[model samples]
Target: MRVVQGTRPLVIFDCDGVLVDSEPLSVQVLVDALNRRGVEIDEEEAYARFLGRSLSTLAQILHDDFDHSIDAAFLEDLRHELYDRFRQELKPVPGIAGVLETLDSTICVASSSQPERIRLSLSLTGLLERFEPFIFSASMVENGKPAPDLFLHAARAMKTDPADCIVIEDSPAGIEAAQRAGMAVFAFTGGSHAGAPGYSERIAGLAPDVVFDAMPDLIHLVRQHMEGPDRHRSPRAS
Candidate 1:
């Protein structure tokens, strides 16, 4: 077990694809809901567009792409239905438990998901208690992913500087947001979105500090970063 010799670094994680295995279920629910309204969208396209985005953003995309009106009330209902149908199926990605346990850093979750959804997903995945009160929702900020607001908010909440925190994300929007926040980012490519053709290159182009296709590899990278001679220095943007 590699150890990070740093003075307790901070790590912020994105929830959906990074913590809980919810992206596929989320995409499926959106597809089913839209299909019911007579809108036909490819699941792959929906996943690409909706992953790491806020519900309001998704609603707008739905309306713009299909010329359909789905009000907040209907959207809430759809989410409730989806949660009820798939909540039991939610689970953490492989090696998450070990990685979290081995971390020498303070950890928190910062996600585009609503607080309630974040609670529900983490709870269902048996990881809710691990974060306790450190979980943050994008609703807490004025803007969601692709905007630096949420990550900045998380850094402030953690009482850490953006340069001292590491962000773990699985979506392009998330990677962009972390970069914009002036934080080093690691793209996790171990979920439903991993290796989705050009995923690696797309994330690389965003200039994440690092990218990992597996959880153990990510943990090892974090350990290495923490143990490196320049552990206290802020990571340079690529």
Candidate 2:
């Protein structure tokens, strides 16, 4: 059922590393695809460069950095391979279901991935029903993350002011996007790939409203942020 908006804050979640443990699989597939094309990239490099970014951004990276061209056939093949892995191995982040159940906020997913990929990840992990009709994708906007267009679009679609929304994200780009959208962001680092060297520090450097590594702690953190004396202040407010 769609959440009926109330006085509760809207929580916007990122799909990949925030909701589903698909980053490792996605990075591995992307690296393999690039290797097959003789681009020679690694999973770590891919994670740093492309995590929380749209497919167009990834294609641009390939074009500019590796001098490789991305055509429809290449994208189709890559999508097919990634989807195959997701079906076989994707899992929800630990305790996320409980977090979702425990929260009373109006929640939705706003992600850098395509709409189909987001739905598949949620369905495979049995989380699709929780976010149907509320999923906003970068493909739906003119610009993706790190530009705030997707997050802002999501806020508008949900009929919530950006100041009244909170974004749960697992990437630097995502946190930056939420901040750019003028929404408070909580950095979630519990995903499997979050422990990469300097990754947490990088996320911290972005100065999200909260940084937490356990799903169970989310409700408390969000409540504190939403109910605390500072709740009315924008995350980027001076």
Which structure among the candidates has the greatest TM-score?
2
* Candidate of highest lDDT: 2
**What's model 2's lDDT at 174?**
92
lDDT of 2 by residue, 1-238 (tens): 1222335889999999989999999999989988998888887788889889999888888889889998898889999999999989999999999999899789999999999999999999999999999999999999888888998899999988888888999999899989988888899999999977778888989988889889889888876766566444443532
Q: Can you write out model 1's per-residue Cα lDDT over 1-238, one digit (the tens) per residue?
A: 1224756668999998898878888888888888887888867778677778987677778778878888778778787887886556778888888888887689999999889899988888778888989999888988788888898898898998887788999999898888888787898888965645566667778777787878877667877777666533332343
Model 1, poorest ten-residue lDDT window?
229-238
The residue pairs in collision within model 1 are none
- Per-model TM-score versus the true fold: 0.89, 0.94
As a TM-score, model 1 comes out at: 0.89
Positional deviation of residue 68's Cα in model 1 after best superposition, in angstroms? 2.7
